[model samples]
Target chain A: MAERTNSKKHYRDNFTGWLLNIPYLAYTAVFFLIPLVWAVWLSTMDWNLMSPDRTFVGIRNFTGMFANPKIIAAFFNSFRYLAPIVVLCFLFGLLLALLISNLPDRIKGVTAVLFFIPYLTSGVATSVVIRFFFSYNSAFNHFLRERFDKDISWFQNPTSAFWIIIAIIVWKMSGYYALFLLSAIESIEPEVNEAAAIDGCVGFRRLVYITLPMILPTITTVIVLASGLAFGIYTEPYLLTGGGPNNATTTWLLEIYNTSFTNFRSGEGAAMAIANAVQIFVTIQLFTFVMNKLNRKFGV
Target chain B: MKRSSKIKTGILIAITAVLLVFSLFPLFYMVIQSLMPWDQVDKSMVLSHPTMKSYQYLLGSGNSSDAFMWVRSLLNSLIVSVPTAVVSVLVGLCVGYSVTKLHFRGKKIIYESLLFQMFFPGVILLVPRYILIKPLANHYLGMILPLCISTWAIFMYINYFTTLPNELFEAAKIDGLGEFGIILKIAMPMTKSVTTIVFLSMFMARWNELMWDMLVAPDIKMQTLNVLISTQFRTMGNFPGPMYAASVLLTLPIIIMFLCASKHFKEGISFMLK
Candidate 1:
């Protein structure tokens, strides 16, 4: 009787284990692994959206992408968009977090909720509002015209448009990032701050030398996240300017989309996508390595 | 002696005021534009007399075409978002439970891979996914399925699930409950807060998804709310009032949802970060 019961229990255990994992395995296999493999195969072929023919052209698409100046320019432009947003968002977010952390609990909660509003709203809606705000007869330009007699064509002029995008990116991200910082800051024991205060580390000095170092891991995570976000900045630029003023705001992803759908070069698009993937992978790996080294140096 | 402190407080307050204005001005402008009488908007005028004409056009009777399309897109968004949220959370729960509780081989590798996938920008997979799915499913199901199993959701689930005490599972196992039964009866009930957070985040992402819908469902009849908003912007050209009106209309549901979910959002981010 005992032996029969043991066998039945073991059989049930095995069956339940398999059943528990079945959905997950099926999902990852169908969605992630299959699409990933298909991307690899598609990258090696001369496939277009309309054409049924997919002639394999090993590594040529990658080489062509590398040789193209436009691709390189788009790559540089992505960096330009990324660097300012990441740095500005982090700095401003930390500052806001420090300010909010000092406030009363209810106010801090309310402020955090207010800041997170923009992050929750659709990026398309935000971009649309921004697009009009920068338009010639819009309120922003109207304000400029009335105040300074300066009617800058915000979208038409590349430099002005670039700065506007930078401003929008920073404004949209700072609040979201600030919430992360606030939570991280809140987790730091109050006694630590009190001890610092006892040690004559008050005001900005305390924030700079104590609080900042304490949240270094969270900061690293935020920076890594911001860098990842920078690479996928398609919808805002796409909606606001349609990669316009002569493709000045065309990002790497935008370029990929244009190459694949608009221009009917699926093979090249796949190659660009792979190139982008490799770039992001290497960038993230390098950042993680650097962060690990920094963590060791700081003994965090 | 205390004057400097007062001065610093004043400066901080001033700075905060400026930040608040900068952050909220675009939304304020959107509201103003939405309320402005369409005929009063002109090149010379920036702010015009407020009117309910735009809102009336959007929601009023006898304006069936615009209202109908808006309602259709809204329904479509709910359809995609609700299912995506439920499925993603359930799948994530199972995956997370396995990684946290089960002593399975290669679990570490799967966990790490899921983490990496979460941090990786999903744009790289967009083209390939479009190409692959265009032939197989070819509709809303195609887009929703690919998006439903987000790396973020899975990572969040794993992180939340790891924090759960393993004693509950052990007790259930001792009680002769199967693994699946333990998860269904014990694990899920214990992690309701985390489940709610996961659902909200996944739903928000799906609700706001535009790129995939645009890529997969080019038909206007099949478009999501985000796509509908984009289409309005593209076709409306320079008409700021109606555009703003439409934007405001589309944003209301999300704003309401966010207000309800803000607490969950905070808890979720804190839990994940921890």
Candidate 2:
């Protein structure tokens, strides 16, 4: 009787478990699994889905991506954006986190929430505001011209346009990243800081030798996340620069978007996208490996 | 040493103050500019003549473009995002509870697949997802269906569920509660914080989304506020005030959510990062 009841309960558990998971299982199968399979197949075909005639031109699209200048530019742009973003966001985020962590408890939450507001703001809205701020005849430009006797085109020059997009994204995201680092910093035991202070490790010495190493794992997370964000940047550049000033700011997403939709080269677009996915996977894995190595080397 | 430490503290406070200004000035300028009369926008920093005409224009009280349907798009955004977040969180809760609490076959496989799904960027799936959902274009189902199952939410719930004590569930079970009963009566109540976190974050994500929303719904009637702002901002150069007003509308819902539950919001974000 006991064994029979146990078997019955097992059966019931299995039944309910699978039943509860059916929705997500079905969703994943349809949206993620099927599309993934279809993307692989489509990457090899030289025809769009809407077209009646389908032709498979095996591996041609993959090899062809390397020769495309836009693809090359995109590949380089990811790193170009990634390096500065990682460094700047790390510095700014660490600073914000450290500063906020030390604030009086009464206003700490307020300041932290205020900093996070930009993260919640839509990319499109912020882009619009920035564009208007820098547009010709705007008060900002008028101020610059009147005071400095200089006129700077915000989005026309490639280097400036690149930095502008970078600056905007950093400003929006650093606050969000700071929250992660702040939580990590707050988790440190009070005893550790007391010991460090007794050892003359106050101020910069304490931050570097004590707090930094302890939160190195979270810093790794922030770096990897910042790098990932670099690849996915589309809306800001699309709105503000249109990936222009010689395609300097064209990201993997923007390029894939223009390719698949505007140019109707779905096959090549799929190839580029697959390349992008591989790039993200490899890059993140590489960062993880390097960060782990550094974590150990730092003796944390 | 004491004087130097005071100077250092002062410097840190000064830096924090400057950072706060940098963080907030854009939003402040946008809101102030939005209040300016249409002709005064971008002409000066000062709101010498503050007016409600921009808000009125968006709300159909004045001459506004037929293409910029603020009311209709706002409704569409709420309709799509609210249900998406709710359904996604509820389903994630169920799946998470099942995977963690219930004895099952092949649960590992399902969990592994979710982990795998995270590594593949959504860009790769764009073309095929577009092809698949093109039939459902301009429909709310197209917008919501693909986003209704979030792996991240499921993972979060799973992590939270594991931390829940099994003894409590066993006691509930002994009291004649079945699986769904225990889940509804105990698990759901117990995980309220996680549920709130998941729902709020998912809602914010869907609300802020642009790329997929723009792709699936090109029609004017079905556009979200985000899509409307992105597409209309470039063309509305003559009436920048209305654009700023729309931007404010875009940000208002999220700011309210943050104000209401910032502690939970911050905790949720930090938990997800971990």
Candidate 3:
């Protein structure tokens, strides 16, 4: 009788937990799981928004993406934007974190919050303001004209325009990433730093050797997250240039948008989406492998 | 050494000054341009005299074309955001609590699936999600429901819920509370901070959402602030003063939201970084 009662209680607990989870499970199935499955199925077919019929073409949709020149260019353009933004943001963020960590506590908190303000602003609204700043007759060009007696067309030139996007990204991301680095840095025990200081390790050398190695894990996390974010570079480029001037700033996501909505090529758009997904998955796997190797090599 | 310290302070001050100016200039420019007399603005003068003409125009002064559409867009944004936050958080809390406390078949698989959704780029879902929701077009349900289940929100809740001691639920169970009651009364209240974080994050994301909003609601009547800003920018040549004015107007809410939640926002970003 006692054993039977114990088993009954355990059964009741399990059932209660299962019952509580019903709402979330239902929601996940409806919104996320169902949609993900649909995405997979849609990838192999050509289906329009209002159409009832979807034609399956086997692996042709995935293979056909390579034949499109715009897709290839967009894939490359994505990296161009990604590399500079990720590297510069990480470097600048680390430097800022170190500077702030060395400051008094009250001042550090205030400055950290101040720096993070831009990251919280809507990217679309900020991009609008940036667009104006780079306009042909805008302040940047006017300042250039007055100072150097030259007119620089920022949006018209691919190289300059690309850098402008990078500037916008770094400006938006630096402070946010800095806050992360600051938290990780603050969590480090003070004794290690004090030991280094006693051994006459101060300034940049101390930071390069002592502080960096301790926070390598956080750095790796930031790099991975930033790289993942780079693949979905839509809002800034879309709002700033609308992938304009011969699609110079057109990243992969923008290309997907144009293909799906603008040109109404559903199959081609799905193909692009699938291709981008594969690339991202491969990139992340490669990044994880490299980071693991580096971590092991450094014993971090 | 003291002299060098003074020099260091001076350099710090200089850097701060430059950064502050760099940070505030674009916003100041947008605000000033919005206030400039339309005629003087076109003349390319720096620091032109301010006027309320642009604001008056956007608020439906003489010769305004469907200026009330901005108000409609704002309403649409709220409609989408409020529902998205409420439903997403509640669902996340339920799922989070279940995964942590419940012993069920395929629980690990379900948990991993949710995390997998987080790393997947949202843009890839555009065409497929559009097709999925196309069957229920022109309704508020169609716009809000598909965007409600964020993988990040669920993951955050799960992480938070796991940290909660299981003893709390066991005590509640001893008091004759059902599973749903424990989740509602005990689990939800204990996780308030994370809940707040989730709600604000979802709200902000939904409010400023662009790509999905553009894909799902192309109609002007259903556009959000981001889409409105985009449309205004795209047609700036036709209506420069009003575009700047609308940009300022649209950005004001987000700026206010940021200032209020700046602390939590930092924590949230740091959490993602980790």
Best by lDDT: 2
Best by TM-score: 2
Clashes of 1: 0
What is the alpha-carbon lDDT of model 2 when measured against the actual structure? 0.88
Predicted chain B of candidate 2, TM-score versus the true chain B? 0.93
> Candidate 3 on B54-96: residue-level lDDT in tens?
8887666643677677777778888888999998788888888
Backbone clashes in model 2, listed as residue pairs? none
lDDT (10s digit) by residue, model 1, range A26-83: 7777767777888888889898877777899999999998787668867888778778
* TM-score of every candidate's chain A: 0.91, 0.95, 0.91
The alpha-carbon deviation from the true structure for residue A299 of candidate 1, after best TM-score superposition, in angstroms, is: 4.7
Residue B194 Cα positional deviation in candidate 1, in Å, after optimal superposition: 1.6
Q: Report iRMS values in order.
A: 3.0, 1.7, 3.0
Q: What is the lDDT of residue A107 in candidate 3?
A: 79
Candidate numbers sorted by DockQ from highest down: 2, 3, 1
Q: Give the TM-score (0 to 1) of chain B in model 1.
A: 0.84
- Which stretches of model 3 miss by more than 4 angstroms? A1-12, A51-54, B1-10, B40-48, B175-178, B262-274
lDDT string for model 1 (B18-99, tens) is: 8788787777777777887776443323564678777666553535565577667777888889999999888888888887
Question: Least lDDT summed over 10 consecutive residues: which range in candidate 2 chain A?
Answer: A2-11
lDDT of 2 at A183: 89
**TM-score ranking from best candidate downward:** 2, 1, 3
